[model samples]
Target: MSVILESKSSRVCINEKGAEVCSFVLKETNLEYIWQADETYWARHAPVLFPFVGKLKGDSYTYNNESYTMNQHGFARDMVFIVEHQEKDSATFLLKSSEETLKNYPFHFELRLIYRLVDNDLTIAYQVETQSEEMYFGIGGHPAFNIPLVKGTNFNDYYLHFAPSKSRFLLPLEGAFINLAEKTLAQTNTSIQVERRIFEKDALVLETKGENAFSILSDVTNHGVVVSYDNLPYVGIWSPFPKEAPFVCIEPWAGIADTTDATGKIEDKKGMNLIHPGDVFERSYKISIK
Candidate 1:
């Protein structure tokens, strides 16, 4: 089922399949800023990443003394979410651990996704509560916005503008996990041009020791999206087959992929957030389209 929300200026569709956004349209311009999930390039629109952000080293992890294999981004995105609340401009979907999930994650928890639309801004909030012992997990957002937001515009015409112009480190992936070495990213101060060659290596995972927000702006269109991540330590920018794909993803993550130096223990993976029994983990990111 698809839940719809509307504001005076825009509207969006959220599918229950993964609690993912399928479409976002600006009412005035009739413009679609969110990707349409064209299978030729990429098939997902905006997927919520939970428990794990990226790939686990060796596609497995050890918890306590048992080894479990989990696919990239965990299983939350593949499960159906129940609608807990709905209003004209907001909706909340929820997913709780079950026997099926415990088989792999072994944690009892509830994950809530609340999406609220106000004017041209959309706020997506995540809440995770633990019902068992300490739980180690990660959560994130993978929202792909359409490039060349305006017709006749070129992808290179757009760029990511970072405020305060600070130098940051990029952690490149070797075999799907972080490399031991760090590379300089956006060293030119601010505004990194969006080009295909930039992603020839892979997604640029900005080390989150500094700045936590960024804006996607186009010199030609003079309009774009601003993403503000509250308390998220990692941000990822990616586009599949950058040359052919027509979308770019701005991701905010509370966790990260297993590092090259990981020991495969779930408790020791870098960037994992821990929640004690009866405790709740809350985080959010906002997308403002201009």
Candidate 2:
């Protein structure tokens, strides 16, 4: 298909069949970590899950009674990512789970993605495997970066930083009708809003504050780009920045979201991940330009 992978300073333009990283061009001179071309990050490398971020509403969800058609972080980025290996900078993409993805995710899977570029940092490795014996899955990373990217950078004089405060903010779940009035898997530290309607008002599920996982969105205030995750549990800071969309999707997830008391078999959904019967799972994340 159209799997273009270039990054030996051709400035990062990866699209291994929606393993998604469509163009991150920064020729030679830089206006900081370029990003701007507006919304489009569906790089679901492994058995799916990651911006399709979090939702369970109408993309259809119900298991056991056998009803599945996941969309919104599950169902793996539209589809197409299987080119086991590549070199010049590093690349590997794959997707497995069928009878058409188990007829909408019933289980039996394999999702692997490994894209690496050294000097300028770009290492995305997400792997998952399970032929059955019990199954459930989650893998993540939706790379997006382009702000003011080139022309007169004015996205609020560019300044996005977060590496200090993290106590609470897992705010966004349109699935079971707003977690059915919050039930308490709880915490508190208000003032959180990052919405862009997709099951309605999406993204803001930051539990355990990523344990210092790493986050720095910049442009002045110390240059930019530094997203590191070798064993991520959760991390996301999306941007349709002030709306009109222009790159900013820093995500890393192992699981979380869609918990209004879930039981949607796929081994009880919610933060899923149950690999057995041939089990295998690996995870990695890193981005450069700082």
Candidate 3:
């Protein structure tokens, strides 16, 4: 099932499954910003990564001396979420830990995805609460926007503008795991062109030193998107490998994949967030249509 939220300038559609945003369209030009799932390239629209982000060592992790297996990006994106609250321009979907989730993520917790649409912007907030003495997890956003945004423009015409011009470093992935060898992605440049070759090595996992924000802009048209996050340490830019897909994903992650020599323990996983009982963990990112 899906819920529709409308503002004066835009309309957004979100599905109960995955609490994913299926569409974001501007009323003025009627242009769709959110990528429409195309199986020929990629099948998901916007999937929320939770409990873990990216790939894990051996696709499994050990917690409390027992082993539990999970696939890439964890299981939240494939699970159905209950609509806990709704309004004209906002909605909250809730997912609670159950027997099935506990089998792989042995913890009692509640995950809430709250989406609010205002004017030409959409803000997504992730909230996690644990009933157990302690809980370890990661959460992130994978919202792909349609490239070329305008009909006459080509994908190559768009570029990503990173804020606060300075040198940026990327943690390159070694076979789906972090290699830990930081490489300079950009030097004193505020923008990078959109191209298929950039993603040939998988997602560009970056560490931005200042305000975490970026914008997709095109030389031919004024239509684009600006994505800004609050307190997310890492940002990822990706598109399907070697596919020349019609969209690009801007991701904000609280945790990253395991290092190549990781010990396979959930607690030991790099970048994972931990929360104790009676505490709530919250993070949010915003998408503003241009």
Top lDDT model: 3
- Which tens-of-lDDT digit does each residue in 1-290 have in candidate 2? 54444555545555555576655444466443534333254322222353234656566666568787777666567677778887777778888777877777676777777878866677778777777776666667656565445465444545444444445445455533235354334232322222343213444445544434444444444445667764666665665423556555667777655666565444565565666877677878777764
Model 1, C-alpha of 211: deviation from truth (Å): 5.9
What clash pairs does model 1 have? none
lDDT of 1 by residue, 1-290 (tens): 89999999999999998899988898888899899888998899999998799999878899989998899999988999999999999999999999999988988999999999999989999999998888999999999999989998988889988755687778787767887565557463578898888777678887665445688898788669888865788888898754579989999899888888899999889889999987878898888888
List residue ranges in candidate 2 displaced over 4 A: 1-25, 28-87, 91-113, 116-125, 130-135, 142-144, 156-237, 240-247, 250-256, 263-266, 270-274, 279-290
CA RMSD per model (angstroms): 1.5, 14.5, 1.2
TM, every model: 0.96, 0.34, 0.97
Candidate 1: stretches off by over 4 Å: 183-188, 209-211
RMSD of 2: 14.5
Give each model's clash number.
0, 10, 0
lDDT of every model, 2 decimals: 0.87, 0.58, 0.91
30: Cα error in model 1, Å: 0.9
